[model samples]
Target chain A: MTIHHHPGKERIDAVRAFNRFYTRQIGLLEEGLLKSDFSLTEARVLYELAHRDGLTATDLGRDLGLDAGYLSRLLKKFEERDLVERATIEADARRSSIALTKAGRQAFAPLNQGSHEQVATLLERLSAAEQDRLVRAMQTVQRLLGGSAEPKIPYMLRSLQVGDIGWIIHRQGLLYAQEYGWDETYEALVAEILGAFVKSFDPKWEHSWIAEREGEVVGSVFVVHQSDAVAKLRLLYVEPSARGLGIGRRLVEECIGFARTKGYRTLTLWTNDVLTSARRIYEAAGFKLTDEERHHSFGKDLVGQNWNLEL
Target chain B: MTIHHHPGKERIDAVRAFNRFYTRQIGLLEEGLLKSDFSLTEARVLYELAHRDGLTATDLGRDLGLDAGYLSRLLKKFEERDLVERATIEADARRSSIALTKAGRQAFAPLNQGSHEQVATLLERLSAAEQDRLVRAMQTVQRLLGGSAEPKIPYMLRSLQVGDIGWIIHRQGLLYAQEYGWDETYEALVAEILGAFVKSFDPKWEHSWIAEREGEVVGSVFVVHQSDAVAKLRLLYVEPSARGLGIGRRLVEECIGFARTKGYRTLTLWTNDVLTSARRIYEAAGFKLTDEERHHSFGKDLVGQNWNLEL
Candidate 1:
């Protein structure tokens, strides 16, 4: 009896062909959208500005991966067209905020409409299940490609707003509980950390930011005052969904920058030995493992670790 | 007992930082190599010309993913520099072959040496085992990324060559033997197919191509005579290592172009039901299942499948 071998290669080839067809189709669609109203660069800038309502030119450069000089020239062009307005921030005279004009919004509305229509048309070709599969495939591609891009340390640092601290405590507590058995002591430690962060809040001396992508908050960190000589790095948490994009490194760099500007000579943070990711970020930011101690307090005993960087 | 969870989030962060570091390092190394003797674009053109040896401006455009017009300009620049020479093929005035000059070889050697040195330097930073792991990881990344690029149908077609037929048989035999428990009968079928391909070769009516990437042959296929009203596609095979890059689709497109030029109204092929990959290539190239048959042959009971495409 001859066993029929499965046609695995054929199925893979079909999928490969579909991928090629889909990419080409999408390229054509994007080109069509571009020809109608905007050049690719202008459209990208519009998309970035629309998503980030008030970003500095420097911030736009970082976010969009544009050269600073080129971006500056583009911004000048946009300003000349009266599509975007730039003004010095009253709070910080050196920094400028960029906001779209009424005409820009009017242009953006139609562009957004056309984009949505194009996406809908493409999605319409696939069955509901196929659309789901395509979206999942796109997410996989994004993860794979995004994983390859260099992680950057974001220059802009803001303060921890409402819901940010709560998220950190909740996520960390849950992850820790899941990994190590649910421990009251671990939860208590997290609460204490949260309380300390909230109690010492100083918008002028301290700051935090939730790193965002596609309108969703993915990671965050905070810089808080310790003394005139030093500042404490606190609540550095990156969500699992956003782990590979270099958000943690950016968060750590934000803390370092805040410390540097606020006249701190040293930066310090406490973590556990098991938290290798945090340790790596600290080390990459020029921190050295100055000291470490092992202690058992929670139901699941683990060694606690501390790391520091001299800014 | 508490299960210690692996630090997935942390590892991801470290990996991201490492990627940033590696890309920047590599970019700097490449720039250093360029500053000494050649511009970046010149180095790339030389590298491509060196590796391909006899590729035309058109072939370079397709392989390097450059625009034909742009590639033509670059080739003109290389010709002006006396680094490359282009000559019309003896049989066809329309076809041109490009070859690198002695100066091109001299320029390419140091660039290649610098690249090797850079790789060595990177490897030196890691332990021997880490170096091996890094190479393996890079292979995986290249495979995944290279496979994801969309395939295109080339506008020009070239006739079948000896290497093309050899690869087709070797790949088909290996893949069939591994995937199905085919024996000498399958080998016999392959031999017969090759013999028929060689016997029926016509420069004006038939075409074949050996799909290449990074100086390696990875796939091949053929178009041959059938009847006054029909043309037969044959020996379509992509090596296992290059299976996912849509090489089969390009080969089929070449065959289709040949068929159209030769005034054939229909194209067809025969295969076993187990050859799913070929089936997919046919389907994606706008073919449909036209016939199916089952027969016990070569000491094993198996069913054969036939498919066709209308021009």
Candidate 2:
């Protein structure tokens, strides 16, 4: 975050290494992508033409990041081969709209399936969970570097995505360690609870909400069924980086709404006194402190509190 | 698969759409990657120099897909800024090895960390499971497109990786559907077995083996602890494309070895009579039929057989 500070050489090397590995990994240097006759650039231009009905040379160049002169030449070649046809735009006669001919569509089809099969070939080897992880990681990479010009944390509440679970566990584990001087015992506690929750998960009686900011998950909470008439609030946390965004408040509201709709007569929760931020959220959401006890856990002797909200 | 047949134009559009989505997702088209001053190409040149020692200007040009003249100019600029030093090769006067100066590394460090943090920011939000998925998917994309000139499915076995479970299940599901018209019941059966295995996974007593060729998983088998002295072999499968490579036999052999080393007295499995290739593999692995019964399952009335190997 400090732009003026000189980062270690190792950090730069790691990034460079990742770039090289990924470039090689994605076959950007391949002589032919998907074993087709087309170069990567040609494949890209063809892909654009195949997807959209009309495009000028400028649009193709812009979308494919091609040079203006180079794109015009390539399009001219396509026209010569009868793979593309150009017509004057009705609104602006000066501009020409490029369209793929039947032959062009036919030429592009195998390449499309080839690419699909290529991805599928890789995907088939992975478990479904693995596939989700790979996609989400890609999303992460994209969201991070993409100058998305929006809030990194959009403050939106959504259904739990695949990696959100482990992320919360890891973050909660480390955040508690750093902030409260708690130990692995806290992470273990979170894991054990999540494991059981996943094992006997009843979607109707149990619901989890993930609060995301600009595609990144910042906070989360779960409402698990204790009985038909009662529910327990569990693992309410917000990343310190994403704090003060009202994400904590929104997560608690989601839990309350879910509990009401699920017909629970009462809601309760257990938290440590050191977790004042979470407590504040609960209190704001109508949860009243019911009891407090001193407990030794997570390598800390602390006051534990239970809170309840009547539905 | 047939080159003569015309692939639907929509298929090509889909692939193009994916490419556009992914490029934008990775922020490739950003004015500056990760909001640093260096262009993507400039950063790439720096990366090549940072990673490899004693590379020449020619080497950098070739490795980075840069024009020789443009690269030479970039190197000249780096020299002017005291960011790089070049030494003439003793054996070849025409070539000189380029090395990054302390200043060059300093210039690159923040950019490197910026990129790393960018990715880390994305990674921190995913659950560990989700992280695994994201990474594995990236690997899949890499392996598929990265022209690995070797066997499509080598007759070699490896320890199971993250996605092998889902891949096997999916392959088995689709293969059975195509080959024998089995329904979703078969997929459910496989999921149930794998789910139970994951729920109580023990690396010491329970082991899983995955067979891969040129970075794609082809076959897999799991040996789970039924008791301290008993092991059960479950979910043995081979990809149809990877069949006839003795992968199934090798997977069975791996299971047997794991069972023996783990000190299991016997190993057992359940399968249908319709699976002739698997039955043959089991028979070759010294498993003998212990029981057989006719049953209605997976939309077919079939004979289910129990096989066991006494270790």
Candidate 3:
């Protein structure tokens, strides 16, 4: 799933705009953060010191990405103001450790409370669902940018609800087209499949697993009864942001588990070879390649493969 | 358009997660931002000094959300390093104005380039389209959070395209449910209306305008032909994020313009009075209330009003 993009001028400009907008939104452009006397950087430093114990100047400089001279000067000022104090480490006498003094904690309390209240004020303009959407959008930005973006809640599988099918069709259509240069035909194919699945849904044998993280759908897979003894897996996909979290493998395993529990002897799936990520997940789940064929579809010449697992 | 929300534990936790994730993503948690010697705060200060001229400590403290003492200490360190120089302000003898020195600019050049390059790297992992999605998501967060969030690109109206109807239905359904506590019945009604609109679409007499900001739909309206001389406006909606931007009014005006161009003498719309924001837009657009009725719909007892405009 390595997509190499040459960002155009538009993307650069858009990102710059967002940075400016967010800076203002978060009061980073204000005289003080959250109407408090601490500058954004000062507030950050206070927050770190208040939350942790015995952090060295090196640690603060490195973690905060501050220059050593700049940080030491800032710390000295904090010490002068009686907001922080330092002690020599017993084991590492040369390295001094620093922590917030009582005054420092007192100063940080208002800053912390102010930030919480500020965010609360922002959230107050939205409904609970919109708040969720806002947070999800922010999380999406974080995930796409790449970082230690762990989902706050582990994804849980659930049955599809109203609008889920349409959402899946829309996303899959757009994603496939973007990632593989597939056309609207791919979207139409998905819509057709889902429409049929919904029209002829059988709860006893057919099931769907929509993986959700904090209410946003991150992945999904569907099990369709092919025969009394066979179940077919379809539409296995994990959102790119949600990938690398074993979601793909988990989705495959879910299909296998469900098929076995349903008393099916075999589970099968078909996918294009270009979908190497999905193929790897399937293969790792002990599904063996059973068939392959050349196909002209979605405006591309591709190799389609089928895999089967004896449940 | 005022909405009151109480931040729940879940919302607070989600925001905290986003803050932590973004802090790491932007390398605020790294030893040095962009692998430079400047901490995130130092980089920010240098950036401001480089971009602007003759900023006083007061200005820097206010604009960068830094405390006066903290900023003065930082500036003094920069002065010692020959990265910054200060001069007494002519108008205010008590104030000193600061600017980045040649050495400061030299140091800041790499930091500026590094920030740009890092954002570029993040964009490079996504396709041009995905890059657009990422920026749009960020903007959505900014808009929802409320700030000086001016749209970089003003919304434009375009004819409805594939998936627009489904998206409108989906969003309207969810939004109405969230805002008004409407039920699934509202969604079904929208689907039915859209189904009929798509089925009986007449380019000569019917039209739809979708308001788009940077490729994402922000609002939509449709003009349906009820008779040769009458045009009925249907399903007008503006996303809450886009509300204050006058999208709703623009959508209504678009409908009126299209109806007049189509030579319709009368343009009419029906909406609930409880939709105060929308009703204001209609009222300002020279629409006059023609009929009102108490009705039970979407599991809520409500007043529905019909407004008419003569072209």
Candidate 4:
């Protein structure tokens, strides 16, 4: 049961407007759906079967919101066309389970292929940036509509995976180039740092954390042994798209906790003064600026700062 | 005509999967539409009538993809209930235009409100950040689905409006606090600077540019007179959501162009070393660092750098 809210007139109108526009847009695509031989309902039924096995006609009808009689007739037509086959649900012999036949899979393959082609054609026209914006916007709608984008503990911090090192280097390189105009030298620096971290073999004294969401890596950080009693935090990074979720802070906190648990006396990190956002997080997490120097790196004259936290 | 592309099988499945998810979500809401008193089609007809000004039965049937006889009978029922009125289309005197009667509007009010409430209820469960993500995702979908989110000139530079200065201050304040963890003093500084700008206004050499997208202000920058021969750029800020789009660079360029066109010999701006992103744009646009000073501002130890571009 849903509790109701009295939304203002303008809010109601805006939503209705969105609905109208979306309906029209979907109608335009309805023409191209599943190569037009199959109606949208028929295509959808085929799609459900293609994606899942052992769904009963009752389940499909309930899921599709089709009338019982309408679904029965549609399934009958599908059976006649040899696109679907039914078998007894082993647990309840009285109930029948629905699955697409080999012919049904073949039929759906074209429709599926056509839909993908359609979306690809749609997306190809956009720049990569626009595609990102579109995808992000879609995520927003889904989230706001009580769909997938929930904010509760969005991403989990896990141990680094095999492919993560390369991904981190590539992302750091690309992102620095795009966001800060740091050139190929930045990428080179990232590669060198990550390479060095991976080349070292010490599981007891060093640890790495990778922030993952929806099977995607969003951030990473490493704590390495600088001395027997000191751990160095290195290669801290968060995806620009995933930034405001406190991933950087969490990663830094993870570093601090690991350093403490490993009996390190102090944790130290080096960063450019220009990276203010990261610096702010460090400052908040009890890291004090210990030293500063002017240097040339990544194709720019930069101010470097060292921060340390007493464990 | 759309050109066909043979996307990979995995990509096709992904699109189909999203379609299935979205269709099911929409289907979940279809139940709430008519209160079991009317079918989805009937409610949709009422919706169209409630939102739109006028439509003939033929037009409504065409728009709804309804069978002619079915729509005719539906209209007859509505007329019997005094829910709709018809009048001649004037130029096409033989045809009729349909408009909702007072009774129609009254009857539709609760349904409209219910739908609005439904969406609100869906959204109310999400965190604000999740809501932002959801809305952004929806925009993305609309853009990709050939709905809205057009890519032509995402933002336009215009003179500041009545509420823009306040909006700029509030936004800059809120954004800096959120992104950089700047304190209330930073917002106070913005207010003071803007207040000063408003007090000593010059319409000739000094100018302000507000970047507007979809009728909302996304960025702002201003040129103020430091001397008769030099123009100072001030308050250069862009909304984080709108950042990555070169608005800052364009705004700076606009300042340079305006300063030169207005016969100023040079343009200057003061920023911090920590503002690396802005600094890069300044460097790219031929601004040379002239001076640096250690200062305490925005409740932090900051390096203030002065940049000047010679016209």
lDDT of each: 0.61, 0.71, 0.78, 0.75
Question: DockQ of candidates 1 onward, in order?
Answer: 0.01, 0.09, 0.24, 0.08
Tens-digit per-residue lDDT, A92-187, candidate 2: 988899999999999889977677666565554544433443455455544433445445445788875433454566677767877888765566
lDDT of 4: 0.75
Candidate 4 ranges beyond 4 A from true positions? A1-16, A33-37, A67-70, A117-128, A143-154, A158-311, B1-15, B34-36, B57-70, B143-154, B158-253, B261-310
Highest DockQ: give the candidate number: 3
Per-residue error (Å), model 4, residue B33: 2.9
Q: How does each model score on TM-score? A: 0.35, 0.55, 0.60, 0.57
Per-residue lDDT tens digits of candidate 1, residues B216-302? 456777677778778888767765545555678888888888788789999988776777878877888898888788887544667
TM-score of chain A of each: 0.49, 0.69, 0.66, 0.60
Superior by lDDT: candidate 2 or candidate 4? 4
Instruction: List, residue by residue over B82-144, the lDDT tens digit for candidate 2.
Output: 989999899999999999999999999987667666656555554443344345545544443
Question: What is the full ranking by DockQ, best candidate first?
Answer: 3, 2, 4, 1
List the candidate 3 regions with Cα displacement exceeding 4 Å: A1-155, A180-202, A213-215, A223-236, A243-311, B1-155, B161-166, B180-206, B213-216, B223-234, B243-311
Q: Taking the tens digit of each residue's C-alpha lDDT, what string does model 1 give over A196-234?
A: 555545767777777765433567777778787878887
User: Could you tell me the TM-score of candidate 3?
Assistant: 0.60
Q: First chain of model 4: TM-score? A: 0.60
